[model samples]
Target: MQTDKVLLEILNNRFSAIVNEMGYIVYRTGFTVFVKETQDYGVGLVAPTGELFAYPQEVGVANMLGMPMEDAIATIPEYRPGDVIITNDPYTTGGMCTHLPDIHLYKPFFYKGELICFLWDFIHSSDVGGLVPGSIAPSAYDIYQEGLIIPPRKLYREGKLDQELLDMILANCRIPEQNWGDLKALLAALNTGERRLTEVIERYGVETVKQGITDLLAYGEQSARAIIADIPDGTYTFSDYVEGDVTTQIPLRIKLALTVQGSDMYLDFTGTDPQIRAAFNVPTFGKTHHWLTVGLVTFLRTKNPSIPLNKGILRPVHTTVPSGTLLNPVPPASCGIRYATAIRVIDVTFGALSQAIDDVVPAAGAGQVAIVLISMPDYQSGGYKVSVLQPMQGGSGGRPVKDGIDGGDFSAGFLRNIPTEMLEADIPILVHKYMFPDDTLPAGQFRGGLGVDFRFQVFTPHCIVTARGMERHRFRPWGRKGGSAGTRALTKVNPGTEQEQNIGIIDILKLEPYDLVQIMTPCGGGYGDPLDRDPDKVLKDVEDEFITREAAESEYGVVIRNGRVDQAQTEALRHRLQTSRILKPFDYGSEREEYEWLWPPEVQD
Candidate 1:
């Protein structure tokens, strides 16, 4: 506590409030539902050195806390009051704009003729004009097909909107008006940040405000270091694979060797598969980017729930994502589906860390977040309407002491599912079912959370459906310490109909009138052995229809008869099953077990 602890706490709260209010303004004023409801946006204040110094804890995208601004800011010739720079080029921005669909805006905050800080924010535009309607397709071969790539440019000059530039950008997009409104909303948020920062300066004076920013960052760094020092120092290695690339059925491997020494951690992704032709590459620019370090960030947060959300937390994290690898791909490699690779990165990081501190980490979660988009012709307007059906996700992994959360993943836990009413009102679709399925969770002492089954029918003819980030079809979420693996994902078209089709995993699909689409995401991996589970819990699960009597008996060795647990029979069954069961440290599903047997880790290394 180099700075006054009381003052640092006060300043931290005030700065966080400023960014949260900025996010609120954008959420209320933005045009698209993605921004207004789903909140696919972020707002923060950056230091002159480019790292975020202040960020909202409870607003916008939760994982975008460490986006760098120095490279993008350097591209600007000079900054004046009210000048805003905009860019969506991932390569040019040094990974600040991760994907083209994410349009980033930065405004320099000036006070007393000096640049004190910067307001940085961005929103995921609904449509940015590309090969697909939503500007993102898992099959995109390169960056050219993803969407518009805007290099760092002066979007606003000298407190005035660059109308020509803005109009040019809008004209190239499918939803011109919506994009324009979202951009305006971003500007409003930046203005809010500017005003609030100015007020803080006026009240506390510029020197104190600057000192406060420095002190807060230092505090965050100290807190992160303390947490990291607690972990046992050692090198741990782990590897995971993407089921397949969009262009080919060959699985892509992601490898990591994490070394922890004192309070410093180094992540090496040397043996990972090279960048594929599809849009799954992550452009990290070989820096310690957010995607490469989010797992460590999550770990720090879990260790210290009161840790500040800033770039200081990443101070001790060092990374080596070799160029041409999936984690650090070269230019021309499509990055529209980078999140697909990022999810695996999170899982692999967890896998490596779990070896060091097994009890602190949970088993593998349902490691995918899919956004279903529907586009069809609007007869009244004679134009197409694009709307997000839902940002669907699966369940988190079972923890050491408790069950996983149902229908939610820990990686993007902040994102909210679209309500059925909202979907029906905006899109021409009928929601028939949206609920958790029974018998899908992995059986364990602390059972995994249940996955979701969403069934809907499209009323509009010739509607196009695209689901991005669909994963875990072949490989199930792995369980640890004798727990069972979770279920696999599935997709169906016209299920239970005469013309039924099994669309196992898809990037884009076409639908006719009355066509039903059902998406069933995977459940999370369980923790501990099923036989170790309490008989009472198994009885409750059966009564609630979460598990069938057969599942309760077979999976957990619990004997249930006529809705009541037979205690003596349950004890006998548990004893018999435990004697026959063979436990393993990691329970990867059969698919992975067979795949690994063919392509062993030693061979890959």
Candidate 2:
């Protein structure tokens, strides 16, 4: 190795620090709720070839660590000193920009007329010109309907802001001023990265720092390979489903086969459904793209705590995703809800890995991250004004030794909660119920985490509500080791009222003044048998109002009186429950049991 190990470690920390500083600039200065609150943004330093060489460790969207930048960079063959490029076209950039609302911008960093690296980041704008507010609709049929597409172009040339380009971009958006504010935030982060990297170069000398980058990438590959080598070499298979997209009642399947031979792994996505007409098709370009293999990145990071966060981590990983499938769709296929598929992709990745090492993996989480947004008429500007309400996420899956998280899952766990002020800040949506549901006594010995039951009333004359990425309605998360399945998701209008109506998966619903809407996200899967759970813990749950007294007795076989335990009754009920019937290792609710009964996993394979 050209660089010493200690020096490489030092460089890794320095690069990560620069990215962290950049991330902070975005969060603090960002304009919309999704940015400052939902944290649907990312910042990092990329190699000249467009792959991330150094990224933030614990800030912003972590799954984007493997985002490919080669195609995006190649579009602009030549770059002047102080040049910055921008794009939101998922197809042209090879999925670097997964959706249109996520505007990706990058600035080239040059050292003595030599290209050192690129400072890159993206922000999910509140609205871009589209079929609805927030530039996303689960029922949208084509990419064009989702939002404005900014093909790879120079937003800044030689540090000169392209005012014309900026004007054209804002022209199509529903809320131009707010999106402009976000663009300015992205620009601020890039400037911060430039100054920081310049300081790094001054301290370490350009040649040495350059050598360190090469060595750091190599170290990342070595560390990642070591993580793979630790897992037992074998072939494992697991499959999961994405319940009914906007077009069909048929659930889309995501099948994975993990072939582990020595320090290399090959993932084959065969027997999966073809691209749908809806907005959830993943645009991975048939490669081991970021969204395709991000679950492994999570697994790898956990396995080797100090592995360098860079593109090199994917060095030992390979994939074969068939073109025109859910994972690798052709251009113009609606992909605004691709994260819905990404959530399932991550689940199936662990599903296959669990077969390899059942004891290490947790049961599945809620399996859905539904984002709620509203668009109302802007009377002042004679345009529509869009605002984010909240990102509704169910709890994480139950681990071998612990219960699932209450209201946040591992898939989108890093995102911060939307402040109450933000939810009612720009819009007239009053928060009615934004708390977790009363427990229905979850499935496992280590029970799944609870989910939210959000209800809001709109005060505007007329409004359009869009809740994309909704899932787990028909098929809830499955449990492991005799655990029961997690509860299903549901959406309602004026719930429990004379005008009550069930609106499971929505494109965009028109709401009148004083109209109420209710949404409940699915919960995480359980790890083990409910009978195996501690009785005292069940009693504690009842005391906390997490579960009803009836649920305690029926689900957990626990008898309580006057907020305390009834030992004798509990013992008899538990004994009766134990003798009832044998339970399967995986309990996939009655719905999925019926689903598999008719079609079967064998035929899907």
Candidate 1 local lDDT, 1-605, one digit each (tens): 45578877888888999999999999899998878888889999999889898888887988876676778888887899879998999988888988898999999999978999899999998888889889888889999998888999989898888989988898878788889999999999999889989988888788888888888887888898898798899999998888637679777899999999998889999999999889889998878888888777888888888999999888888889889889888999998878878888998998899999887788888888887888999899887799888777888888888888999988777777888998798887999999998767688888887789999999888899987788898899988888889888999999998989989777789999999999999898998898989899989988888888999989999998887889999999999998997987789989999998998889977
Q: How close is candidate 1 to the true structure, as a TM-score?
A: 0.98
TM-score of every candidate relative to the true structure? 0.98, 0.97
lDDT digits (tens) for residues 1-605 of candidate 2: 69988887888889999999999899999998889888889999998877788888767888897798888888897988878898899999987988888998999999889999889999988888898888898888999999899999998999888999999999998888889999999999999899999999999899988888877778888888887887899988888899748677789999998999889999999878999999989988877689988789988887777788998888788989999999999988989989989999999998888878777677888888888888888788888878878888998888888888989888888877797876787676788988988865476788888888899998887799998788899997888877778889999999988999999977789999888999999888888878788888888888877788888888888998887888999989989999997887777889988989999898877
Candidate 2 to truth, TM? 0.97
Model 1, global lDDT: 0.87
- Alpha-carbon RMSD, candidate 1: 1.2
lDDT of all predictions, in order shown?
A: 0.87, 0.86
**Which ten contiguous residues of candidate 2 have the minimum total lDDT?**
438-447
Worst lDDT run of 10 residues, candidate 1, spans 242-251
